[model samples]
Target chain A: MKYRRSGRLVDMTNYFLSHPHQQIPLTYFSEAYKSAKSSISEDLAIIKEVFEVRNVGTLETAAGASGGVTFIPRVDIYATGNLIDQLCERLEDPERLLPGGYIYMMDVIGDPLLTQDLGRIFASRFRSAKVDAVMTMATKGIPLAYAVAAHLNVPVSIVRHEHRITEGSIVSINYVSGSKKRIQTMSLARRSLKPNSNVLIIDDFMKAGGTIRGMMDLVQEFQSNVAGVGVLTESIHEEEKLVNEYVSLTKLTEMNVKSREIKVERGNLFDDVYQI
Target chain B: MKYRRSGRLVDMTNYFLSHPHQQIPLTYFSEAYKSAKSSISEDLAIIKEVFEVRNVGTLETAAGASGGVTFIPRVDIYATGNLIDQLCERLEDPERLLPGGYIYMMDVIGDPLLTQDLGRIFASRFRSAKVDAVMTMATKGIPLAYAVAAHLNVPVSIVRHEHRITEGSIVSINYVSGSKKRIQTMSLARRSLKPNSNVLIIDDFMKAGGTIRGMMDLVQEFQSNVAGVGVLTESIHEEEKLVNEYVSLTKLTEMNVKSREIKVERGNLFDDVYQI
Candidate 1:
C-alpha cells in the first residue's frame, strides 16, 4: 500500500534495518508502495542522509535495472570504542571468575543488545568482499555467529561437538585442542554448507585458538574457505598463538584466580580495521 | 548532539525498534538529543502513530516519576496469519523430512529475519503479564529462545543435556523423554536464574513435550515459575502428550520417510490465542 512520506520513511527504515547486505531492486519498492521510481529514489535519498549522518549504516545504491540498494551495517569508531570499554568493564567483574579461571561468558553472549553491536563490529571488518555463510561451534558460539549472519544476510552453519539424530549424514573431524592439547571431534551436517563457499568464523571466547583452528579445519572439509575469524575476547594468556589471522574485540590482560581481580584491554578491532 | 524533528524522529524510531519492551525516560532523550522534553514527547507521538497504525506495536507512556515510553511489539492477526502460512510452507518441504520422524529445523531457526518475527509474535502474546527471563534447552533451542529473549528484553537461561565445566556449579535433574519414553537428565547453571523469578520457555520443536516438561521441572528446581511454554512446531504423530498447556506455531500432520512427503497445518497459535 502507498503511504505518505512520513509513513514511508518509517517503513523504509524498518525494512533496511531488518534486511542488511542484500540488494533490493528499486522496482520492488516502487511497485509495492504504488509509487513512481523517481519518488522511491527521492525517498531513498532522504533515508540515506539520516542513515549516514546518524552513523546507522551505509546505503549503497546501484544505477540500472539490475541496480538496487544494499545496507552495509557499520558502527562508528567512537561508538565501537565506547561499547568495548563497557564490555571490558563487565568482563572484569570479579564474580565472573569461575573456580578454574574460566570467565562466565554466557551472560554476555546471551544478551541480544550487546551481541547485536558485537556482531556488527565484526561484520564491518570481515570479508565484506564476499561471505557465503557464518560458521561457529555449537552452544556458546551460536549467538555471536547468528548475530553476524543476520547482519550479513547469510546462513549460519553450527558444527556440533556431539552428534544428534536430527543432523543426517554428518562430516566429523578430530582436531587438537591447543590449550589442553587433547584431541576432540567436531561434526557438521553434510548438507549444511555448500562447497567452495566462503565462511566467516566467530566465537564467544578464544584462549589458545584450539576451537577456532578446529573450525578452520572443518571449513576445509566442506571445501569452503575461511574468509575471516573474529572473537569477542582473546586471551593473552596464550603467548604463542596457534592461529595468526584473527581480530578480537577484547583481550584478557590478567586474571588473578587467587584474588579474583581481572584486567581486560581493548582488542585488535581498531588496529585491524582503521589502521594500515 | 541536537537534531531537527526529522532527524530526531529517525533516531527515536531506531532506538525504540532495537530496545523493545524497555522503558526509556523522556528526559534521557531530551538530554542526549538536546531537545526539550516536550519536543521529545512530540516526536514519540508521531512514532506511536506510525507504529500503532502499522500494527508494529503499542507505545505506552507512564505518567509521573519513573515515567517513560515503552515499545510493546505486536503483530496484527492478519500479519500473524501470513507469517504462519509462510512458515508452514517451509516446514512442509519434503526435503525437511528426516529419518525417524524428525524435521530438519536448523535452516529455519538460523534465519534471523524469520526468527525476529517469530520472537515478536511470541512476545506479543506473553507481554500482558510479567516475565523475568526466557528459558530453553541447549543446542537446537538456543537460537529460538535467544530471539524471544531479545524481544522480551530478558536474559535467556540455557539448560544443557550435560553439565559443562564452563557453566560452573549446576543443578541437574532427570525426566522422561516422552517420545522415547526413556529417562534423561538436564542441568542448568546455578546462577543463571534467580529464585522465584517468572520464566517463559521456548523451544524449536516438540512432539510429546518431554523436553518442555523437563524444562518446567528444572525451573521448579530453581524455585522459579513457568510463565508460559511456546514451541515452533509440534508433531501429531504422538497419541498423547506429556504436557498440556503450550502454544505452537505449526503442526506437522504427516511425515512419510519412505516417499519423502510432508504435510504441515496451522498450529495452535491462533486457535489458542484469538479463539479463546
Candidate 2:
C-alpha cells in the first residue's frame, strides 16, 4: 500500500462517521489498500482511540471467516442535519400524492436504507435530549424505535393493538384517535415502563396528533414526561397540541386520491442543514 | 483544529468496514483529532472513493447545525459471521428462558443494534447467495425480516395468519406447526412476491421447522426457490427434517419455567471467529 505522505485521522474518522455502521469484508479493505494486515490493524487502533476519546462514536472489529469491523451511531449535528435535508427533498417531491390528501410515502418508509439513515440521524438528536426510553406503537414504529434505541443504546418498548400472548400483562390506555369520535385503546406493560420516565415519542405518521396525543396520555399514566416528539411524516393541520418540539421527514397537507393530486410540504430540518 | 499526519484511504475503509453504519457528530471527530475541517473533508473524499469502488458500503454526510454522519450496512462475509457468533452467545444466556422450550430472544430480536448487527452478519453470509427478498411471518418475524432486509438491501415480505386483515388477499399454504396434529395455514399476498423469487426465510423461533417448511411451500406455490433459512432460535427435536442448511442464534434443547432451568447449545459461529 502506498502510504500517502500525509495520513489524516480526522479525515478518516469523518469518512467513518459518514459511512456509519456499514459492514464490509476485510478482504475488500485489504485489496483496496494493498497494505499488509498488520498496518491496517494499527490504523484501526488509532481510529478506535479517536472515537473512544470523543465518546461520540464506536469502532468494533470482528475477526474470522465471517468477521470485519463495523461503525455504530455517533454522528454530530452537521452530519445529522444534512441527512434530514435529503429526506425532506424526497418528501417534497410532488409525485408523492395519494388518496385523502395523504402522500404515498410508503416507498420512503419501506426503503431500509433510508429508514436506517433517518433512524440513525434522529437517534443522535434524541440521544442528547436525555430521554429515559424510546417508545413506538406496533409495526412501522418498531423500525424507527429500533434505530433510535440502537444509537442511544436503550431498550425500545413496542405498544401493540390488543395484548399479545407474548406480553404477559399490559397497561392499557383508551382515547379518541385523532378527531375520530370512536374510542380506541393502546396498551403497554407495567413491567415494561417505569414511573416518571423521560420518553421520546416516534412514529411512522402523525395526523391530527390524536394517536401521538394518546401516546402522550399513555406517558402521563406512567407519570412519565414527554421529552420530545419525532415523526417520519407530519400531516399538516393547525393546532397540534402536546408537541413541545418536533422533527419530521415530510409534511402532508391535502391529498385527493380520487383526483390524483396531493400537496406536500418539507420540514425545516433539511433547510437548516443546507444553510450550514 | 490540529493539522496532524493523515491516515491512508485504505486504512479508513478497512476501519469503516469493520464498523459499518455509525453516525457521529462532526464536532466530536474534529475535537478528537484536533484537525482542520478542510483536512477532515479531504479524508472523507478518499474514504468515499474506496466505498464506491468496493460497492459494498455507503457513506452519507449530513451538513448544517443539526447534521452529522452515518454509515449504512454494507458489510461483507468475514464481518457478518463474527457478529452472529456474538449474537448466539447473547441468545444462549440462561436469563433468556421462557415457557416451554421457547427462548425469549424477542428483546434482542426487537433491539435495533442487535437486529442491525444480525442483519449485517447474515447478509454477509448470504451475500454471494442469490436472493430476491427476505421473508418472515407476521408479528415477531417483522423485526428479523427488517434486519436482514436492511443488510441485504432487499424488500421484506410478510406471511400472515389464516385470517386476512393485514393482508387483504393472499396466496395460501397449509402445514403443521411443530407437534400439532392439526394443520394450519400461512398466507402471503399473491402479488406481493415476484414469481420465481429467491427467498431467504427468517423467523423468531423454529420449534419443528414446520412453519418454515410451510413458508417454503408457499414459495414453491409462487414457483420460488428457498435460498436459505435462518432462525433466531431453533429447538432440538428427535425428528425434524434437516435437509437444507440453516443458521440459528441459539439451539434450545430443553426448558422448564417452573424449575427455572434451561439448556442452551451455542452455535459454532463463535468458536470459528475466536480461532481466527
Candidate 3:
C-alpha cells in the first residue's frame, strides 16, 4: 500500500519513537510505505527537525548501503530540571519520612509517567556509553531498570537477594550492607548476561552504595564491564560511599525522623563532572 | 513558533504515541503549533486515518466543551497472533526447562520489547475495563505490570512477599499457594493504593491462581475493587483453578521434567469468553 507524505510522516514518527537506538534500513520503510527512498529521507529530515525543536530526541542517520536511522531519546536540560524539581518537591513531603529515616518512595517509583521521564533523563545521560543490558536489584529498582532498558533498547538483568529455584544455575556474591554494615547476599542467573557485555546499573535509592558495589562485583564475575551507574535518589551520609562514581537524579540531604523533616535537592546530574 | 502541516504531523504523532490515553485539547495543539483549530483538526484527521489504517491505534475525539482527543493503543488480531506465536515458540524451547519443571522465563520477561508487547496485548484486552492501577507481585511481574500501566497511562501497585521498612504501614494477607499448597504472606503499602480504586491485577505466570487471589484480597483490604486479572502464562493442572474469571495470553498444556519437553499454546485470549 502506498502512503501519502502526511501519512508517512505520522507513521515514521511513531516508528522512530517506539524503536529507539535501532538502526532501520531505508529499504524497510521504502517497502513498508511503498514510497521512494528520497521521499523517506525527506520524511526523516522533517521528523528529525521537529524532534530537535521539540526537545524530544535526535535522529542519527548513516549514509551507506548498511546505513539507516537511529533515534536516540533525550531530554533537554530545562525539561530535566523541571522534572527533577517536581521530584524533589514530592520527596520533600514529611509524610514520606518513615520511622527509620527511610522514605516511602514506592508510590513515586510506581508512577509510570514519572519513571518513564526519569528513564529518559538517565538514557540521555548515558547516551554515549555502551550499555548492552541494564542491571538492578529485584524489588524496588525493577521498574526504573526496565524503563531505562526500554529507551536503550536492551534487556534487563535483575539481581535478586535470594536465589530462586526458577533461575536455574546462578552466581551469588556476599557484600556488606552500606547502612547497617551487615553481610548480605546477591545473586543473578548465569544466563541473564553475556561475558564482556557493558552493563548500566540503576537503582531506586543509594546510600552507602553497597548494593551498587555488589552489582559491580557481580558484573566482574561474569567478565563484564560496568558502563555507568545511575540512581533515582541518594541519601547524604557521613559515612564514605562504597562506590566512587555514579549519577543520581535526586539527593536527600537531610531526613529527621523525630522532627518529620525531609530535605531533597537535585542530584549530581548537572554537576561539572557530567557537563550536560 | 508556527509549524507547517508536515512538522505538526510529526510532532502530534510523537505526542500521541508517548501520551497514550491522555486527552489533549485541540487548543493545546493549535496554540503550540500556532495553527488554526481547523488546521489542527485536519492534522488530527490525517493522523487518525493513518493510525487506524496501519493498526497503530485509534484516536478518540470528543466534541463540544471539555472535548479532546485520546489515543487508545491497540494491536490488530494478526499482529497479536504473530506475537503470541513467537512467545509460545520461545517458551517451548527445551533449554528453558529447569530441574523442577519450572520454566526459565527470566530472559523472556526481562526483555523490554517483549514485555512491552505483552503489555500492549493486555492493555488492549482490558482497554474497555475501568482500570485505575495495574497490580502485580514483586520480582517477576513488575515489568509486565509497568508495561501495561504505561499503555493505560496508570500507576502500578506492587505487592511483595516480604514487607520492607520503607513500605510503612502495609496491609498484609496470608494465602495458600496453589502449586505447593504452602501458606504465604503478601503485603502492600497502605498509601500505594487509594480507597475505592479499580485495580487490574497482572502476573507473569499463574499455576492455580493463588497469588492473584491473594492480591485481590489485599486490594479489597484497602477498600478497592479488582477490575480485572491478567497473566502472561497459565499452567494446566489436574487440580481445579482457585479463580475462574481471568485472561491468559498463553497456556502451558504439558511439561515433562524427565523428557525435558514443554508444550505451550494460545491462552483464552481468543476464546468465546474474551471475543477478542
Candidate 4:
C-alpha cells in the first residue's frame, strides 16, 4: 500500500510541474493515487519540498476539509520574454503566412500552452498595476485578453464583431479594422464595464491600431479609465497613432512571405518584470 | 512593531479569505504592513487559526527565505462545477456572438481565479490518468490547457499550424480542418514529444472533431499515447467520429441564428469530479 502511494506521489509531482498556477483538491489526488487521503497528504508534503528546492514554483495547499493544492509558474522575465521573441519570429515568416494583405496567424493563436505562458508573463508584469478589468475586441484578441486578465485576477470584457443573443442591451461603435475604406462594428454590453473602471486593453496583433482605438472609444463611453495596453505582436513600420504607455512583447518587421524570411526583436516589458 | 504586526495579521487573514488560493511572498505582505519579518511570523500564526475556524483555505508558510504564504481555493466539486455551468450559460447567448457562429468567451478564459478554479476542478477529474503532458493546438486552447496543466504540473506540447524557425526541424502533416474540402498543414517539432508519452488532449472548442483528430494524428507521429480528451464547449449537433470517452464542460446546440437563440447544457464531467 505504501509503495503504491509513493508511486502516485511521483506521478502527482510530475503533473504539478507542468502546470504552475492552478490548485487541485486533495481528494482528487487521493483518488488518482488510489490511496487513502492521509497517504496522499504525505506524498504532497514531499512534492512540495521538491518545488521549494527548484525555485520554479510552489505547491500551495488549502487546508481544512475542503481545500486542495495548486502550483504557480515562477519563470522570471528573462526566460519568458525569450519565448515571446521566439513566437514573434515564427509569425514574421511572410511567405509562409500572408494569403492576401492580411497576416495568417490563426495557427499561432490556436496554440494553447504558448498563449498560456505568454499570459502568465504578462500577469507578472501587471501584478503591481491596480487594474479593474481586461478589455479586448472579438475573435483573436479574446485569447490574449483572457491570458492577461487571468494573471491580473481581473474580469475580462470582450467587445463583439456583431451583436449576439447573450448581450441583453448593447452599445455599438464602428472602427476601421484594416483601412479607412473598410469599417467594422465593435459592440459591448451596456453592463459589461463598471463606471470609472481602470481598464487594461490587450490584443492578439496590431497593424493600423484602429480596432484598439475603437476599443478605447468604447471605454470612454463608460466613463472608465485606461490603465495600460499590451499587444502580442505589432507591425514595426506602421506608426502608432495614439501612444498611451503601451508595451509589446515582440516587434514584427520586414517580412517576405515567399522567401520565408522574418525578423523579430524583444521588448522592454520583460526587463521591467525581471528587475522587479 | 509587535502591535502593528498583530493588527496586520488580522487584516491579512481577511484579505486571504477573499483572495483564496493565492501565493504572496512574506516580504511582500510584510512590506505592505511596514513590519519586521519576525513580527510578521507571529501574526501569521494568529491568522492561521482564523483560517482554521473559518474552513475556507489554509495559510501555509514555507520556512526558507524564499518561502511565503499561499492560499488554496478549496471548495467542494459541486460549487466548482456549478460556476463552470454558469460560465457556459454566459457563453450560450446566440445574439451576443458573431456571424461566424462563434461565441466570444475570451472573457471567462482570462479571469485568473476562475481559470485556476476550473483548472483545479478539471485536473481533479483526471488526477488518476498519469498524463505525461498536456497538449493543445493553439491560441484559444492555451488558457484552459495551461490551467489543467498547471494543476497537474506537466509540460504543455503545442502543435503548430505551420513549421517555423523556433520549432527547429519539424514533422509536418496534412489534414482537412473543416468540411474535408481544404487540406490544411499542421506541424510538430521532431524532438518536442518524448516517445510513448501519456498525453492529455485539450481544446477550447470541438465542432466537427477534425482539429482533435488532427491533434491525435500528431500525437501518434511522436509515438505518444493519448490518455484522454477534454474541451470547454462541445457542439451538440456535431457528430463524433472518433471520441467516446471525452469530457466537455458544456454542450451548445439548437442554434437559431435568425432569432439569436441557443441552448447550453452542463456536461457530466463535473459529476464525475464531484463523485469523489
Best by TM-score: 3
Q: Would you give me the overall lDDT of model 4? A: 0.66
Candidate 1 chain B, run of 10 with poorest lDDT = B267-276
Model 1 TM-score is 0.95
Clashing pairs in 3: none
Question: Model 3: runs farther than 4 Å from truth?
Answer: A273-275, B273-275
Give a tens-digit lDDT track for model 4, residues A1-276. Answer: 223542354346445643444568887876655678887777766655544443344567888777778765444655665677677677666544444334555456544446656776666566556789888875567666766676555788878777655345678988776444478888887777788999998887666677788888889988998887788777654555444466777766766656766776776565466532
| Candidate 1 DockQ vs. native | 0.63
**In terms of DockQ, which candidate is stronger, 1 or 4?**
1
True contacts kept of 4: 0.15
lDDT of 1 at A263: 93
Error of 3 at A212 (Å): 0.6
Per-model DockQ against the true two-chain complex: 0.63, 0.18, 0.86, 0.09
Tell me each candidate's TM-score.
0.95, 0.67, 0.98, 0.53
Could you tally the backbone clashes for each prediction? Answer: 0, 62, 0, 39
Predict model 3's lDDT versus the native: 0.91
lDDT of each candidate versus the true structure: 0.85, 0.65, 0.91, 0.66
Of the pair 1 and 4, which is ahead by lDDT? 1
Tell me the TM-score of chain B in each candidate.
0.96, 0.68, 0.98, 0.70
Greater lDDT among 3 and 4 belongs to 3
Error of 2 at A104 (Å): 4.7
**Cα deviation of B128 in candidate 1 (Å)?**
1.4
Stronger candidate by lDDT (2 vs 4) = 4
Error of 2 at B20 (Å): 8.4
Say which prediction, candidate 2 or candidate 3, comes out ahead on TM-score.
Answer: 3
